[model samples]
Target chain A: MDERVLLTGAEGRVGRAVLGGIGDAYEWRLFDRDPPAEEHDHEFVVADVTDDEAVRDAMADVDVVVHLAGDPRPEAPWNSVLTNNIDGTQTVYEAAVETGVETVVFASSNHAVGHYETERKPDLYRTDDDYRLDGTELPRPSNLYGVSKAAGETLGRYYHDEHDLSVACVRIGNLTKGHPPIDYERGQAMWLSYRDCAHLFERCIEADYGYEIVYGISDNDRKYYSLERAKDVLGYDPQDNSAEYTMAGEPKSDV
Target chain B: MDERVLLTGAEGRVGRAVLGGIGDAYEWRLFDRDPPAEEHDHEFVVADVTDDEAVRDAMADVDVVVHLAGDPRPEAPWNSVLTNNIDGTQTVYEAAVETGVETVVFASSNHAVGHYETERKPDLYRTDDDYRLDGTELPRPSNLYGVSKAAGETLGRYYHDEHDLSVACVRIGNLTKGHPPIDYERGQAMWLSYRDCAHLFERCIEADYGYEIVYGISDNDRKYYSLERAKDVLGYDPQDNSAEYTMAGEPKSDV
Candidate 1:
């Protein structure tokens, strides 16, 4: 798609992943508190998402937004999450509405429903176990950071309902470059490879919806997050499966 | 209950209603931006809910908090609702969590599910119709104000799940002093009287719940909001009925 897209938190991992995968696909306006590490062809705006004027300015002529800016700490204090994640998200949404932007692809996390993992452990993580969490479950955040993410998702819902903005909240699983977290079964079960992350977000940018939430994970055989909605709605076809890679993150070439 | 409770928005209509109905039932610390219009026996603190230090200080040793501070206008813009209602509620919740408080009684509004009314309209407002919203359905906010209240409820859910704090969100209906809105069938269907409003909140403070949502309208014959959850969970047995009052709000002594 050649629509003008605004990618917030361009310096972060998720933002960089989107840029690395499809940076040239769209006319880009990258916004972040810090500049990117390497030079890029897209226009960059060095401003916090909480800065209303700068955000509104950067939002001009943007059609879609991939919002990933926030405190990414699971143990972050209430104050930090409240201001940086919750309020910053609100600013992004309000500015997006003001600028007549069409869609916002929010970076929600697995932590929004992390309690399910704690509640249904060992058996739930087993390879044969089939209990799955679709995107429709009520948010059960495991920490204050998770709470902030839940709040952001709810904010997207509100903005969509009240302003008629298309919002796609991606409850992303464990994302790592090249492979899953080494020797961690839980991580492998929810592992989302970098290419899969990029593809999922690309689907989010291209998808047409009112307000929707979908899991952002690869086609892993042991995954507990159901990607049916993502496939049905956004036509997301993830490429890599964590099962093909060993716990040490090496590809099973013999298979 | 004789526990020391902190009542934010002590100067508002809901606060005044609670104070009028149950003034001597509990020890209270009243907080508001403006001092009460008249004198009172309870200790009062003048501060905005957004002021973090002041809110935290007011929360000391408080057993329960009745948070009512917000911009109440249904047509309120994003900035006012986001700051005054959403952020303010977050501050109250964070302070409650920090101060080791047991519970928070949030004052949500009927607007949280206002779309049902818009959709059902005259048929639903009829005295014979029995369609009801039982607080189990997903929030369908009709305005930005409603969106703010929904955000507050979600925040409560997160705080409850993460911090082990008990929270009760009361989706209050049309609250009138003596009777329902004049000559308005919709208002009559969702009216919450002063005494009933106070008793509902009293139940909110004393009841045991992990995270719950209950309708706050009195037991009206034409009601569309179900009170079963309130009765079963919080022991809310409202005494007043809007059907017992005339369009002019006078008591129907000879029904």
Candidate 2:
């Protein structure tokens, strides 16, 4: 597999996590709607995912794509979500196919299956509720943004099935640095440490699949989401856990 | 509950089956993208599913919506499927949510779960595979059009869970009038009799559920999909069977 990758939305929080670790490992070509403050190791193209021409230009000679460019707000409105997420994702997928890119690691969110939370929340974080969220479960997105994310995952599937391209959808959880927020049980259960985030995405680039949906978070003891698929498919082995930061009943640190 | 319903795509082949018998009972506000040649008892709106304002206007005071709009061709291109199936569906669902409609009997197709056929296809049609396609199984759509339909189902789920809007997705089988098509064993086993189509939709109007996914075909002796859920949930008691038209081992009719 070629190490030459074009990472869109490379200036965002998840983007930084990826670049901070894998900067020297691969031949990087980053694209962002906004240019980052600090310079990168390789070429950085400032462009919008909605702009097809710009995406096409940035996509030239790229072996793989990590497409994360779009609106990420949970409560994003219809019009904004339409252009930023749905239309923009279509543009990217089309561009990837047009450019003959091998693989795409799409950043799908937990909200793609968020409605499960209404019934499986607090207990999923506690020592009870043996119930777990598997990748096989049908998506029940919570908001328009979640709908848009789900749309992205479906786009990946279409491209893969129709065009023979490989794709992986990472249903990412709450990402935090050093420690998870205090009293936020849900976030703690789903926390993806910065180190683990980078490694999980690295697996996205390395692994092989026709089309897959895997959870991207540290292997927390409180999690209801099964990491078996990720481990078996992507060779993922998460390191960090939210249990280290919390005391007996609550969090010890106040961030 | 009111026996009256507003059904879109009421002139198509599948629509004809659902409309032929139910026409005698419900006070329907029938609609079709294409204007039908014959006169009807209920109001018909000859407009596109993308037309949000027109749909919402028609949805006023209606208790249920049996939406079957959009291009149903399984091999449609990306743009065609994206706009007609995905975008049109989003518009309709948005309108349904806006109008405070109680239930939506969405015409989801068997192709939405067609990927499972890879392991058990022509053989499964001849003899039961001990495996049956259920509503709860993960969506493994075989084509882009199927992917679009799955997306529509997910959208229904979101609306139902988030806004208390009830939705029922019917993964319809090979719908034919008199008998199954020639050289099409898959169609024969999965044939949905015309009378049963009307019967199933009528059940949709009567059944009570927050969210459901049920097969929309007759109870055939030569079948793969289990009808337990449809029977239990929608009270779907199909009157016609494919075996009645065709004799054992000897060929008869291809409707």
Candidate 3:
């Protein structure tokens, strides 16, 4: 096998974008709870990530897993997050350990630290507050969905801590089409361009960190995140920025 | 009321040390699965932390909780660690949120970061590598028991981030008395003197930090952890060190 990689949630928007970018880089084994419309890469495995047997089977002959299979709704209930996100992540990690997978790129979200926006609002986005959300800051999720994402990040931490699995948690910011929201201030400040997202995660797949959390955003002028840590640790270099589209963007009045 | 605190696991080793130190500082409502042998200075409630109703009933009038109720054995079975430690901790945090408690001083353990020792051993203690185990370092627990402690810390994080409950996680080192074994270098380096343990926890109740992870070791020449974070964040001032007693005077040699 030429660096076989398992891509869970291969049909989702983020997953598809990642696959579209790096699908040819490795021998891909696509996985999703529901089947995709078109064939993905080389192999496809349709199954729920929470199913232990299914995950274990998917890990066979695979060296790495881009685990993106979970309920992504911001308003998901605790029961949904518990089963789909938390338990599913635990199962994936245990199986990765059991199968001797060397690395995993967990799909952690900005929502993992979403409440920071309320505290870091308007000022960092539009007004002048030189503060930024670093990966080192403690997670403050705004909803149950964010809680699930935080749990996934912790699972990566546990797997790396216990099994020494190289894991990277990308606290992805808002991702927009073609480019970031051209005139939206907060979105532009937080937008992770598609090219940047794929390439940053590509760094995650290749970097050697015991366990790390890095933001996924382009080099945006309005970004309220410190990209220095990510650049120093993961060697991430984002080419695009939301600033390319607009100078005076709309205000985010969510308090 | 001057200040009221709920001390969980009032019978455990760490809990007893904390109780002995601050028994007079705050009006305590002590909780444990097994009641104490003698009368206490304040109210004592015999209740399991896993029981939400019991925890809630005992949480009333509590300003802060020194949560030391989970299974502490480093070699405990997975089932026990899961039910008693992980689930029980979730229950405690939920109950705290339900009762609107202000802060939680969680007793996290060194084993949460013990695997780092095995990987860099001999050098860490045997040789003078002096690779300090800073609180910022990602945990690499050596055992399932360590995983449980990590889970407890995450529970504290979730409660703090989501519900605005104040939390402080203390990654306690090896705690023993009379002296740390000189022959057992790991023990000596990681030893937490009794008074230091008590006083360090006393600071947990006294100082303020929204969410923090701090090393629970006194200022010792042989220490492998940095106490700067604890001192800066929690105002912790430890008063004892194992070096005060010669290692030859200690009974145990096993680390």
Q: Is candidate 1 or candidate 3 better by TM-score?
A: 1
Candidate 2 ranges with C-alpha deviation above 4 Å:
A51-57, A247-255, B247-255
Residue A139 of model 3 has an lDDT of 63
Scored by Cα lDDT, where does model 2 land?
Answer: 0.83
Per-residue CA lDDT of model 1 for A1-87, tens digit only, reads: 679999998889888788888888899999989977889798999998889999899999999989999988888987788778888
- Mark the 10 consecutive residues where model 2 chain B has the least summed lDDT: B244-253
- Provide the clashing-pair count of each candidate structure: 0, 0, 0
Q: Rate the local accuracy (lDDT) of all candidates.
A: 0.88, 0.83, 0.80
Candidate 1's residue-wise lDDT over B81-149, tens digit each?
A: 878998899899989989999999999999887876765888998888889989877677887788788
For model 3, chain A alone compared with the true chain A gives a TM-score of 0.93
Q: A17-62, model 2: which lDDT tens digit per residue?
A: 8888777778889999897788767899988998989998888988
Instruction: Name the better of 2 and 3 by DockQ.
Output: 2
Cα error, residue A24 of model 1, in Å, equals 3.0
> Model 3: how many Å of interface RMSD?
3.3
Considering only chain A, what is the TM-score of each predicted structure? 0.98, 0.94, 0.93
Q: Which candidate tops lDDT?
A: 1
- Docking outcome class, model 1: acceptable
What is the DockQ for all candidates, taken in turn? 0.43, 0.54, 0.26
